[model samples]
Target chain A: MKFHYPNGKPYVPKANSVAPQLKKYKNQVYSNRGMTLEEDLNETNSYYLERKIAIIHKKPTPVQIVNVDYPKRSAAVIKEAYFKQASTTDYNGIYKGKYIDFEAKETKFSTSFPLKNFHLHQIQHMEDILKHHGICFVILRFSKLEEVYLLEAKHLLAFWARMEEGGRKSITKEEIEELGHHIPLGLQPRIDYIKVIDYLYNLS
Target chain B: MKFHYPNGKPYVPKANSVAPQLKKYKNQVYSNRGMTLEEDLNETNSYYLERKIAIIHKKPTPVQIVNVDYPKRSAAVIKEAYFKQASTTDYNGIYKGKYIDFEAKETKFSTSFPLKNFHLHQIQHMEDILKHHGICFVILRFSKLEEVYLLEAKHLLAFWARMEEGGRKSITKEEIEELGHHIPLGLQPRIDYIKVIDYLYNLS
Candidate 1:
């Protein structure tokens, strides 16, 4: 697949096989398949920001940057840095006077979306957002089926709590279809998330 | 000054110069300034984000990452990158039901703050923000004096217009004191910008 960088130049990954590379990391072994989900969402975010429809941004995983090298003075190259676990969702912004916060995940499973894709901190963050009356949801993409669903945080939290009581560790495709709304891809606005947001807010 | 990294480790910069090294290419000199005013604002932003007061961040100077090295698993290092001009202001976010946008700058000059600290694109961004009813301003820090001022964008534009009419290339200290509000440093928040913001919003 041909892709362009933010500078309009062609973009190609240094590691040809990102899945295998990600699997080598002990912590990310199970979370390896959906690399493209992040890239696609990033592109979609740029689309939203450029049109001024919203100002959402993917917060960079907080990194403890140490030992930066100033080679001749261009940009400082971070020689050593360690990723720090983020305390909030992957994406957050303001849309139409409401705070919007969400995380995007993709899974290969055809029948169910596994609960392991989310972390405890993210769940707590969503609960906090809910308390503040902010709009929060997760965008789950079934890569094999090429379908995306906007699942509200309320539904997610209910399922999450049920898991502790021996409920299903995953939400079935049927459940997602019933509880969530599908987001269609378009030319101008690639992901069309705001449409889902509008529906969720107005309907609720 | 002693500081702890996000990982709870001590942060120690290389023993070169505390001042940021400058890289000059062609005719333009890019000063790293160890931590530029941009970096200070980023720290202040993190402080705000962590405390749940506001969410503001510096838009990474859009970079064209041409080559990245996947050295160790899960780590992507940019081997070659080039800076691309940004289309918007450095900082923006929502606070207390209002959109906030601003640029930060530091001037070494003791008497006057030079107009060259700002770019045309930034001025245009502030204009756009003002047009959309967003709260926009410039954060100016006089380093030698250890003082910071929040100058409204309207006042900035007024001076910028006069620049083309062969006016002074910078705003005098007296003008800043008269036209802008001084930001008092605090213990917990450090930079109490939102207080100044509240004053700005309520005054109007």
Candidate 2:
């Protein structure tokens, strides 16, 4: 389905074709796909910040640093560390007098998104946010197909419930297309999510 | 003047000191007397987060990366970087349906706290938050005297205005003790700033 902005400009992912090289150092793998979903969201956030539209930020993943090396006077090097489970979503902030929280993920699958992509803790966190009347959702990007969907936590919860009942473990792309709102990319704010948010808030 | 909790526990700076070896690795030139005011505030924030009292965090200072080394499948190593100016305060979060923002600073001097410790951008950020009706303040810790003060943005702005007009650029410990509320240290939450917030909210 074609997504159009009120300004008559068709939405396109900014720098979608330019793949940035991933950097790795000392047995660590970092995903570098031109511009990461995180980077795009960050750029969009900066755009919002400059216009005073909202105050949102990506939360750093909590890490338990086990070892460090002091080679010089200025820098601290983490010699050994393990990924610690994050207690909350990656992004949160305030907009229009309401609290906003979300996680962004990208998949290469064209048919459906895998349920394994999200952790149990993240799902629980979303559930808690929903209970508090805060805006919560997942920004899913099918990178291979270059499609993005803003799936509300309500829909996610339904799927999660089915999974708990030993039903289908993942929501199919067809299901997403039917249930989720397509978030079109834009120039100023690459991921124009406020419109999706407006829709969700009114629906709720 | 010594600050004591109502429970008869003395406020001690070295209660949660980071290890000296870790400090050495981090190239922390500041005194290892205890967890710096920032560390204590971070711990206090963790306490609040665990109990779901608030969701405050210190924003890492933005850094401009000049060089990075990628070796094998490991985390990317930042070879060279420069600190970029921050446009906001170090700490911000939501508390009791209101936005909370503040900066934590400590002083060794017994009588006065230096104004030079705060940057102009931070002052502007506080002003912006105040304009937006957010609760903003500074967490001032007199380490040598082992006292903490929760001074409102209005008070700091008053001092800043005087400083602009060729007045003393620092707030004396005596003045802070007179105008600011002393935050009592608690076992569960350590620096109990919520109590101070309640006082400020009631006053306003």
Candidate 3:
């Protein structure tokens, strides 16, 4: 499938498949069926919703509709539109009486996660969420390693500050692994991110 | 401007302008500049956001893109798309450590607001929100009367139940006035619904 950024530039994923040179642990089962991080999270959210565990949802992609054509009988068709940059994170909802908000991203590089994956407005949104005592975090997936981590927004903000101060432009894998909580892949809830949230917030 | 629903049916506002036939109250000021309920809410949300008083936002209109055309050196334009019926409320955010969720609607009838304005999925969404203890409600506008009220979600649920039991398909103006909190229009905030929430939830 072809993808394009809002600016019309063709978007190419860093890596779509696991690197052939990487070693695989036989004991760790890869049951994801090659699902993307977003697909896994969507499945997890659906599980949570069905079981009454949480009410989280991914916001729909924003678009700027410039023109629309309404046929005589058929549905109205958008003739012209453009993608718009999101002002907030992708996922948000209420969990255990707390507001939850986060963005998800997958990186093929095992060494670091690029800071460019996030927009500045999203960082500002996280700050606002934090000020309001909402549960704000990010779900980072190392696609090549089949590893996922839940990192608190404060840590991301700290790294973003460092980047703004002329430091490294990416969060090193070591920093993410040390500061973030690992979420084991599961069958029912795919990523089991809520478990990490439970442990972090003492909601369990 | 023309608006179409997810089903492609043309959507007509109940009343675009306040009925000039209604008696004018000399003491009251209508400072909204003839903006629709949505525009006023957007302006109010912006005001709240800028003032650091709250972090509320209107969710973008959901659209499903079917086709996109990428022209070299220009923005990718959506060629075909359809609106998606929202499965959740229109507005949601965190305010004073609480999850706020609500839908805003305007009606021309001064006697009652039709319950058909809501969908089953949205009611279910509100129920989930309530189960999670998030603050939930609806902002209703009687366009002909130029009156706005913040009605609690529980009240709406009760009215919905009554409708399901073959009761009136609408909530009477008398009932709303008695049960809902009146949101006085103001210059800075346009519709001060947050104040109503502060009073309803005792956040202030």
Candidate 4:
């Protein structure tokens, strides 16, 4: 099942991909229509932002800039740098006066979402978010089925803790279906996550 | 007066600044000590994170990666990238079940903090944050004076609107002192902004 970006364009990564994510979305429309779960969420978040429904954004991937070359009157060129691991969940912001935090990920496996989809630090960060009273969850997309679910972080944490005791290394799809909210695949806003949030958080 | 990390060390950039920030901060303590307000904020955030006090983090500078060199297996090296303008505030997170967003900027000017330190989109972003009921502010540090203030977004927005009408281009120290909540310079949690937030937001 091919997921379509409201525009009916199939979500497929362009072959020989080599372009910055945002620019590919903007400067060149239809240039990179094969949207990743991250990209789809970005679009949905943008929708929420534009309508003043929410204020969430994906944090830029951290990079250790080693050498920057200032070439007169132009943007600074980063000559050398390396990707740094992120400390927290990817998407976070304010929604209806509440701190909303979550991470979106896609998995190829249809049976279960692997625990490896998240880093240990990310799980800890979500635990911290829960402790801080923020709304925390994971948007798990089964890429093969084009199915997405928003599972509260508490559930993820529970499973993660059990893993330490030799529990299943992944959360079965049935468990996800029972514990998570289904996010209908859509067009304009791409992924209608806020609607699920409104229901989940009991927001008007 | 030099601002010191709570552990009684003047915050200075560690001699060799090539390592990634979080790793450097963790592995080489007092190492990255020659620090800027940004680094101090990061440490303070880490402190808050550890204690589960607040969930704030500085956004990484956005860069557009164009070319990468996979010379070795260890890590992919970003060879060509350009700095991209950020469209939002630098730091944001959640605290006490509320959305908290802020930007920290330091200027050497003794009398005023320049408006140019922020881009137009950022000001608009703050306005949106306010509309959404998020706690939004700017951390202005008079580097020379070693004084910091958490100025509410409303105040900044007021001056920004006036700027278009040919008002003062900067906020005077007197103004910041009067309208902003002064954040005590401290050794632990250097900025100690949560105290200021408590007062400004009327949180118990």
Best by lDDT: 3
Residue pairs with clashing backbones, model 3:
none
**lDDT tens string, model 4, A38-99?**
67887788788878888888888788877777688886777888888787888888888889
Whose TM-score is greatest here?
4
Model 3, C-alpha of B99: deviation from truth (Å): 0.4
Clashes of each: 1, 7, 0, 11
**Residue-level lDDT for B46 in candidate 3:** 82
lDDT of 4 by residue, B103-131 (tens): 88888899999887877768878998998
lDDT string for model 2 (A1-204, tens) is 232232345545334221222233211344454246777888888777667777677765454344544577767555544444565678776666567778888888899887767766677667756765667899899998888899998888778767666677688999999999998887778897877887777732
lDDT of 3 at B174: 96
Better of 1 and 2 by TM-score: 2
Candidate order, DockQ descending: 4, 3, 1, 2
Task: Name every residue pair that clashes in candidate 2.
Answer: A19-A34, A20-A34, A27-B73, A27-B74, A28-B73, A28-B74, A28-B75
Candidate 1 deviant stretches above 4 angstroms: A1-39, A42-52, A59-64, A73-79, A82-84, A130-133, A163-169, A202-204, B1-52, B55-93, B115-133, B157-169
- lDDT string for model 1 (B111-194, tens) is 999888876666765765676567889989887787889999999988876775567779999999999999876555656788
Better of 1 and 3 by TM-score: 3
- On DockQ, the stronger of 1 and 2 is 1
Cα deviation in Å at residue A72, candidate 3?
A: 1.7
TM-score of each: 0.67, 0.72, 0.83, 0.84
**Candidate 1, backbone clash total:** 1
TM-score of chain A for the candidates in order shown: 0.79, 0.81, 0.83, 0.83
Q: Quote the lDDT for A202 in model 3.
A: 99
Q: Tens-digit lDDT track for model 3 on B106-171?
A: 887889999888877787788889989999999999998989999999999888777766578899
